[model samples]
Target chain A: MTVSKDDKWTEKKISRREMLKLTGVGMAGVAIGASGLGGVMKAMGYELLEDDSTTAQNKVNFYGPHQSGIVTPVQTHIYFASLNVLLTSKQELQELFKQWTPLVVRLMNGETMVEATTNTRVPTGDTGEAAGLDAANLSITVGIGPSLFDKLAMQHLKPTALQDLPHFPKDQLQQEWTGGDLCIQACADDPQVAFHAVRNLVRAASGKVEIKWSQAGFNSFPAKGGTPRNLFAFKDGTGNPTDVQELKKAVWVDNGWLKDGSYLVARKIQMHLETWDRTSLKDQEATFGRHRDSGAPLGKTQEFDAFDVEEKDSNGEYLMPDTSHTHLARKSGVQMLRRSYSYASGVMSNTGAHDAGLLFISFQKDPAQFIAVQNSLGRMDKLNEYITHRGSAVFACFPGVQKGSYLGEALFNAL
Target chain B: MKYKSLLSVLVAGGVLMAGCGDTEEAKKEDKPATEQAEPAKEVDLSAELAAYKQFALEQMDQFLMETEKFVNFVKAGDMEGAKATYAPARMYFERSEPIAESFGDLDPRIDGRLADIQEEGKGEEEWTGYHKLEHALWVENTTAGYEAVADQLLADAKELHALVQTVEVTPDLMITGAVDLLNEVSTSKITGEEEIYSHTDLYDFKANIEGAEKIFDILRTKLEEKDAALVTTLDEKFKAVDDLLAKHATADGGYVSYEALTEDDTKALAAAVNQLGEPLSQMGIILE
Candidate 1:
């Protein structure tokens, strides 16, 4: 259960990228290891700086009936789908970004506007153009690539080569997609929306691009949304952070490439429990390793309060069962920043039923770290027996603040 | 008795997410990470992007093909072609239904329309005979009953065909209109006047265990193609479940038994179902 040196990076507050920018380039990752930002830069192809410049955006959305569908029978009204878009890229890297900026503004529902930063309060309105924005429930994310290359490499505004791909350059011309592209984090509210968006997107890509294969479903999953979000009764992500708990940054702007800005995005295909109700509450608690009364691990009462493994009796043995939810979560060394929502089956009758269950979501710095948390939930967790895995997909987003500069998206062809 | 039948086929075949909206929804819950690169001294930048592009294209290509193949079966009337194809289809579904449950926010109208097919059994000819199958899918969500109704419809269609050729009767003009029913179905989400079902309704949030059991039984007995095509699809599906099981299993093993897994994980008391149930169902078909 011991974490690697990468563990400490996962615990920082300002985010290693932002810190790197503020601390000065080259000096970034100076204290870290070979496997640290510097080494990862060599293997991956990125640059890192601890500066004060604006960053990429993180988008998380909720698509389902406008209201709750778990316990109420309100016809699962207000059909809507929530999406979480993440953009991880470095700005000041791309050359012909106009074609890309318009698309980002349209998708994120924000407009290019103007205003002036003041001496006191937070700034109102941007400094460039002027207009209104409409990102309904959509959120576009942007994150600074944290790779060692990104930490130390100079901005890849120079020419680069992609001789590997047709129509690409061989001179190492910068901005040929050394970062990422919209396709890397592209998606839609519906299948047609997605298809159409991607069609327009690839047409926009005039150069060579390299996309991560693991994110094959970057445009799929959620398989369905909106009214379908709450047909069943189980609440998903009930324990997730709500509107900036202890983890949120103090200020977040939504303007220009950031109007209607975002936080982070999480995705999961939670198993439904239509047939799970047959068991007793006691049994159910045992399955989740947490108690139903307070949503805490067995032996603990408070919901959000941390589980006290040391709360033992005279015998000096563990208080909460080691196999309990909180115990295992702690032992597994992963935290659930989860935020779940339910979806309803489009059709249901007296006998046959429709689909319904939780769409569990969470966010963290490294997928591997979050993975550790999810793994604990997998092992000996009380909920395991009653639930089964269905679908899975992953994405890497950037902290977006500039138009057309999505993480990895801009560099999709460059690297 | 809750007669058992876990015969669940992928509704509307299997739709693939073709663009960005696909990523935005799921993107909401993840922590964004920026990947970096090495200085160009030794690494071949062009070679790298090239290799990555090939891998991406290949995977996307396979997924699209698989998705299209599944949907075409239904629209082309092949879903009912093999009775046994239904079982493996159910197995794929039984494992998926729970996760599909997230569509808790669906409009009952969509499901209601489909439910009417079974309850009233009157919309069969009224919904434009030419593309009755398409209507059964888009308007009614009758995917679960296609097999049950195909036989009856086949007989009816044959009789209609004879009457037309012999001049005993005129062909139902409506049948001719079934022309682009599939294209229509595909565009239903876009052009439909009313807000019926959304992408969320597509999820199987809950398990229709009873429905799945019924379908699997039939599929086990009659699916004809035991060859590579059938085996491959079935294998990929099972692999999906196996991967999930491995990811979610408890550390000590014996994670959740099939029994535990079957019960609604979200509830404290799910009902019991019969071990086996009758597969006989009165289903409908399209004339076109």
Candidate 2:
């Protein structure tokens, strides 16, 4: 609701105690007392001191720099999502939108919409010959999935609950569920920001909604100070291209463009709990392209250790197996930022009747860059079969996040 | 602000990570000597941009008309519609402004919208973040010139949607997906884990990608409408982008521009753009 160049928003640099305060999880803060806190602080490269208050209340986004992430983000979004139960009628939807009007007052700490005298300054110039950044805008879409309906059926003990869920032939299970098929898309400048917005939204919809997943979407690199558009765990995308073809030209029409600069990748990651658990400590490390215990390269225990492909075995072959998951990932290209996530869909029938698995999603500037690594994985990938894909969506990432705007809006605009 | 490369952002972030983590003790990691190395060369990214210049003028026309329309309503005291479109319009401009960042110095039309706005926070719901254009469309009713041109942008967006499936199952997607799934399980705070995710949530995402690829093949090689001239340029572009991708990709995974961006180098940019780019504001989105 407030916007100012002064950047008065207090940088929400959550400390160990703050995280503990937010998640209300373990004694992470308590155990890190004095020296412990100091040790943790040492690791983070920050002094325990911080200024909580702001000089002016005009800045909506926190301006302080963080230890990690791009200091000044090209793209920054903090989404706020709410999972509301589907109203059977359009009239109800309209009413909800109406409800949002009055609620902004409560949601924004009493800030009211005002026609201000001060004008927001903007860049005024010519749009040159090159393609503009299209990823400035973002959109929210809603859909009804069978699993959602099944969950609803389960809630109300609906007789046709089983039919609603994707995994339906179980006649007995079907009769005991309340079907549902409505979902919402809430977003903003960063996943962290989205969390705030979504939290408030869901809170407002408490009785009228049955909250589903409220995830921080996409693992991007820090486009803004919030979340990485390519949030590859273990810091992927240490290398990538800065420029590709201009947006105005066509790759197909353009006769002379570099094939090396762009990339495309697709992967299906299946979680391996049963098989992974069966493996010994060393075997587990081998399965993942990295050390399982330390999340490091195959030969090293330290996180973010430099990978040396030349290290060899007695046979003069590479010490790290060529077929190792890590090896394939390395071979394709380093332009990838691997931000990933996981899911567990209750328990399955002992016979594995369930089709539950991982939904793989990866983003790169060019699809071809990740294609080589993908080809290496084929069906023989170290972590295959254990994970299965179900729902998939792809978005051409726009340039980056812009201050005082939502993600991907510009691209959506021209469209 | 010109568009800086993602590599630049990541490289900049790496240097900033000298102090981080929740525990006070975790904030003090040893700063490596190499971490202090020189950054890449800065480029005039805006000079490389391609925006729809005509679209800006059209948007402005619409903005004026819509403003007049809303003002007329306001004059008549039609507060609801005026308020209804207000927030949406404001949010729309805010959201759409970032696209100009990529055009560091290239496009003048994009620069215009980024630079000036008569109103700060005003517009409709659906129009939020794209206020400039949406205002032009609703209030100004300026689509006389662009009603036809809009099909191009819409068609391209659809094409991007159709192309998501051109990618298939691979290690990168798997690694990325698995990581995301794990994060979901670990961080979910909905109070009832039982209700949030079904087995389909796990597998459906990959299934959707697989399905999208099938759709891509039809759009690219098999579509009857694909050879219809309008999309013919895709043939050359895809091949070029594909080739450039293979060359610049890394041995350990990451963007190729990583080196150039951190060191302020534009070698990768020039090489990639010259090798893989087209001059038409190429807006391709892929799903794999």
Name the top TM-score candidate. Answer: 1
- Tens digit of lDDT per residue, candidate 2, span A1-415? 1112233322445443474343234222221211210122222222222322233231222212111111122223423122435344433433343343222222222121111111111111111111122212222222233343343343232112112222211112222122234333333333433344344344433334555333343433433333222211233333222333422121111111111111111122334456555666665455555654346677676656788756786788765666566776666544453324333444556556432333333334444434445565555555443434333222222232222222223322432
Off by over 4 Å in 2: A1-196, A199-270, A300-302, A308-311, A349-361, A399-409, A412-415, B1-288
List model 1 lDDT by residue over A1-415, tens digit each.
Answer: 1123343453344544454354334333222221211122221122221222123232222211111111111121122222211222334234223233334344433322211222111112222221332222233222322232333353352222111112111112223222222223333233233333333333233121222211212111233432122222222233443354433321122222222222222333334455566778766665555566455556667555566655765687656665655566567554435434444444435545444444333344334545555565555565555444432332233334332123334343444
Give the per-residue lDDT digits (tens) of candidate 1, residues B171-285.
1111111112112222331122111332211112112332232233223322222112222333343333334435435554323332333323311111011101101110001
In Å, residue B175's CA in model 1 sits off its true spot by 26
Error of 1 at A15 (Å): 34
* iRMSD values, candidates in order: 31.1, 21.8
| Model 1 accuracy (lDDT, Cα) | 0.32
Each candidate structure's TM-score, on Cα atoms with residue i matched to residue i, is: 0.32, 0.29
